[model samples]
Target: MELDGNALGGDLSSVFAADVTGAVFVCAGCQHSGVVASLRVWVPAPGLVGRCPNCTDVVLRLVRTPTRAFLTLTGASRLELPLD
Candidate 1:
């Protein structure tokens, strides 16, 4: 199943002070840049994974538990968030 970055809005919001879905992510693997909303997402495993559309690099990962949420942004070289 494929989802978009918006699918992480609810869970990611819990950890981030800003809205993650509107943030722009730069792919570290291929230097591709795009908004999180445009990434190809896969949510079938224990976590949520968002990959780059241009290079298929994993840009976002979210793992949620009853007590904690683990987010990994290793595939992203930069993240630009909305000011307001």
Candidate 2:
């Protein structure tokens, strides 16, 4: 099943200093640009995986443990976060 990026709010907030749902992401694989909230998300995996809506490429991956949170955006060439 695929959930929208909004599902990542709480998890992402754990790692970022500000809300990132409105952040824009540019896919490295196809150069597709979109807001983070527009990505497709999967939750049943080892961690939360967010994919680009345009190219279906992996855009971001986030994993959280009791003491640590891991976030990777290797699939995204650029990320633009909203400033205040």
Candidate 3:
């Protein structure tokens, strides 16, 4: 999915393509420029938060959706799916 540029804290977000290769990239907010390993993505329970691998920054906040496939991020595009 295409991330909103305004949602990113800085230019680092620009480097991330919507079609992520599941490879974790370095966090621009921190000095640690090492490659992110073991990248994992999942829908978490209520109150759970997603964090950056390099700097442990809270990147995504989880929320409930009406459908199993609500959003799709692929090939530099963001697609919203209807509830099925």
Off by over 4 Å in 3: 1-28, 31-44, 67-84
Ranking by TM-score: 2, 1, 3
The global Cα lDDT (0 to 1) of model 1 is 0.87
Predicted structure 2: lDDT: 0.92
- lDDT per residue (tens digit) for residues 1-84 in model 1: 887778878888899898888889999999998888888888688888889989898888889989989989999999999896
- Cα RMSD of all models vs. native, in order, equals 1.0, 0.8, 12.8
Per-residue lDDT tens digits for candidate 2, residues 1-84, read 999999888899988898899999999999999889999997699989999998789999998999999999999999999887
Q: Over all chains combined, what TM-score does candidate 1 have?
A: 0.91
Looking at model 1, the pairs that clash are none
TM-score of each: 0.91, 0.95, 0.30
The predicted structure with the larger lDDT, 1 or 3, is 1
* lDDT of candidate 3 over 14-44, digit per residue (tens): 3443422333344434533322222223333
- The residue pairs found clashing in candidate 3 are 1-73, 1-74
